[model samples]
Target: MLHGKVVLVTGAASGIGAAAARLFASYGARLALLDRDEEVAALAAELPDAVALPYDVADRDAVFAAVEQAAARFGRLDGAFNNAGIEGLGGGMAPTEGYPADEFERVLAVNVRGVFNCLAAELPRLPPGGAVVNTASVLGWLGGPGQAAYAASKHAVVGLTRSAALEQAARGVRVNAILPGAVATPMLLERGFRANPDFAEAAPGAHPMGRIARPEEVAEGAAWLLSDKASFVTGHTLAIDGGLSAR
Candidate 1:
């Protein structure tokens, strides 16, 4: 589906990002995998025709430089899946009244500012056919008690995705976001499940599907949004939440 395309995926070390990277590569996309972990290099090695570029998404200058370097190396950038983010300290579930200031700042730095930084760096370099997929959460449209900071960051991402899509649409560059529900990931396991030990086992009941979504399930949506298959789709917040967001 993505044959001969050049795509960039952030947070590519593990979880959804890693899953997306592998899926995109399977569809014949040459990948530029970005992440802060050294393991990113190993993950890159596991995929065919991929290069792992290790860097923190929150580092504005580094993000710009890395995008430039990747585009230069590949000759052009076709699409991007800006999926790097953090759930915040303890899943950021603390009530607003007592949420730690430092943790709030750190979460915004990676989740909001990171997306802003990537869009800034990528917009000018992307050609007319390019597309971008931002990883948002079901929380963007709903409320999570005790998760004010994290929820706010995701809401900002949704706003950014919409505005960026408008700015790029006329040029044929599409920007969209995927709002996922409970997925079996490290972040979810640690923070989400920690908040509710039965969350892993119980979350599925909340969804109509009777099971939590797999990372690959979400990746399928992202890959389509980034591909020509979704040529007319833009400024859209696609809910791949197993019906959890419906209620």
Candidate 2:
């Protein structure tokens, strides 16, 4: 599917990003796994051909540098999964009026600016037929109570994805976004639910499938988008939400 391609995956230490890295590797892609977590190196070590890039996507200059480093190591960048993001301060579900200003800024820094940085750094380097997938969320489409910052940031990612797609379409570089529902990721199970226990039970029911998604399920959509199989697809938002968006 991705034979000989060099793909970059941000936030590759765990959850959906980690799953995407492993899946891309299995498809014969060389990987440039970037994460703030040092554990990303161990994940890279497990792969046949991968290099762990320790980076914080919020840093614009660092993101550009890391992208360059990946191209240098792999000879070219064929695809990228810009999946580095945060659920914000405690899933960012606090009442809007009481939501801390600093926390909101922090969420925008990592979620919004992170994707912006990646796109700016990556697009020029990707050749014709190369692809990029930005990780938005089901929250990007629908609003919920007490999730202002996260919802806002993800919505921004959707906007960015569409705009980038339009700009790059004629050049033959496909750009798309994936909107995923609740998934069993450490950020959600460990951090999000810890902050709002009620959601642990409620989240599954919110999806029409009546269950949270496995990280690999979401990764499958990403892998397809970044492959030649989705050659004609661009500027599209594919929902991997198990019918949450249908309702």
Highest TM-score among the candidates is held by which one?
2
After superposing candidate 2, which stretches have Cα over 4 Å from the reference?
Answer: none
Residue 243 lDDT in model 1?
94
Error of 2 at 233 (Å): 0.5
Among these predictions, the greatest lDDT belongs to 2
lDDT of each: 0.92, 0.94
Q: List, residue by residue over 1-247, the lDDT tens digit for candidate 2.
A: 9999999999999999999999999999999999999999999999999999999999999999999999999899999999999987766378889888899999999999999999999999999999999999998899867888998999999999999999999999999999999989999988888888888869999899999999999999999999999999999999999899999
**TM-score per candidate, chains pooled:** 0.97, 0.98
Superposed model 1: Cα runs more than 4 Å off: none
Q: Candidate 1 lDDT (Cα, whole model)?
A: 0.92
- Model 2 clash tally, residue pairs: 0
TM-score of 2: 0.98
Collision pairs in model 1: 93-146
- lDDT string for model 1 (16-108, tens) is 999999999999999999998879999889888898889999999999988988898899999999999999876536779888999999999
